[model samples]
Target: MTDLRQLRHFVAVAEHGHFARAAAAINLSQPALSRSIQALEANLGCNLFDRGARNITLTAHGQLVLEHARRLLAGSRALHNAVSQLGNLQAGELRLGAGPYPAARLIPIALGELARRYPKVRVQLLIEDWASLRRRLLNENIELFVADCRELRDDPLLSVEPLRVRPMLFFCRPGHPLLALAEPSAADIAAYSLAATQLPEDGARRLQETLGREPLPDIQCDNFMVLKELVRQSDVISFAPEDVLTSALVGGELATLPPREVLPRKGSAYGLVSRAGHSLSPAAQALRALIFAGDVVAQ
Candidate 1:
């Protein structure tokens, strides 16, 4: 049997591509870390690392083992979280991941609802890109994620339920030059710099496809708040889901460009994505339900 500690060490080394750095990261002495890897490789009857001239690399066998190790580790974490929350949702932490847009709208509502229903449950939100969120979900870094379903739809290891299908809208600060025209052409919109928040490649690609040409983004940010502030203060235009702009629009700080027909009607659908075959904690379940309910009301 492989030791979880050794597997963790291996993952750290592989991630950093250097043993000394990995040792420092995991707070283990370099020699001790080396011995642990040696022990792991000996037990498995194969070398896990290729100690080459320039950079440390995973052997072919190490690559295969790394995948299995990650799955096993993730399963162990899920089991632990499930067991910890077996009782009433009185006290257990729920780690969640979400994209910038959904995080802005959904999390606060769900957190409030969850607090009302389960006051003792603690929650931590990890706002990240779709790729990082998926990786975290698989590795058990997050209990669940709410994000666009473009890539999650086909992933065999994960399960997703639709939350909302929202249309993309262009936004600019009130009295923006672009809004001066009744209808701005693609060229007209492209003339000014555009800003966007944390868009996945597929989402960006789809937007480009809709425009029939690539328009360079002058500013790309990971947080919707930052992007909103940039758009709110500057003449920069932004493209995002309607729900994401609700507060700003309602507050009269931002205005949508006219002629919605010019843009693509179909946009991304976001949802709850969790690892398949894993049991979610009671706290996670409650939060998921709240999210689903809130999404329905929003729709």
Candidate 2:
């Protein structure tokens, strides 16, 4: 029978590309590691490596077996972690992928509560633009996701649930002309230096039509903090979730563009999304519940 220990030795050698290195990695003597590999080859009735004096190369059969062995080892590890330990949230890694907007507030608040509860669970957050975040979800790099509904992408293996909605508002630095001056048309907004999301033309066509011009934001960015800071430092104007900059707005950080009767931009809804087919772990489920349940770390 092909022993699991021999297979581990074979995998270690294949991965390191050198028997001496692999032996050192696994804390086994080089000759013992070689013997383990030979035993494995005998069990399978085939030599696994072509040791060409300078380096080692795997035969076709060896390549195939190595791939399967790695997969089996990974599966075994996952199974052991899942079954052997239950509800010990702090022991494993939790990866959450979200666009910049939702991550701005959601990540800090959500993670704060998670830290208080599962202090040992390692949390990693990946922030990407709408386009990239969608790709990562499809690639299965992240288990949980959240983004604005306007850019809500649907894949057969993805499920989305509507979360909190924040109103979008246009604002500029405190003394910008847009505030004290008469209500200007979308054409007027285009005339000034504007900072906003780098949305594709087709996706934001209606917004463009309302603005009566191609959406040409002079300072295009996806980070709310950076965008808000630029507005504070410069006379730049921006349109974003009203709540995203609530602290900035209240603390003399930004001033809103007067509500316009001529052109009404509607509020946008942000949704909490996850990979459709994969089951979420308890830690992920708990965080998701807190997200929709409006549980946030009190500011």
Q: Please list the residue runs of candidate 2 whose C-alpha ends up more than 4 Å from where it truly belongs after superposition.
A: 1-85, 200-203, 260-265, 295-299
Candidate 1: where are CA atoms >4 Å away?
52-55, 91-93, 115-124, 138-141, 150-157, 197-212, 215-222, 266-268
In terms of lDDT, model 1 sits at: 0.83
Clashing pairs in 2: 90-120, 90-121, 157-276, 158-276
Candidate 2, run of 10 with poorest lDDT: 76-85
Assess each prediction's global lDDT (C-alpha) against the native: 0.83, 0.72
Residue 251 local lDDT, model 1: 95
Candidate 2 lDDT over residue span 88-134, tens digit each? 67466666777767777766777787888888777778877766776
lDDT of 2 at 86: 61
Model 2 / residue 121 / CA error / Å: 0.7
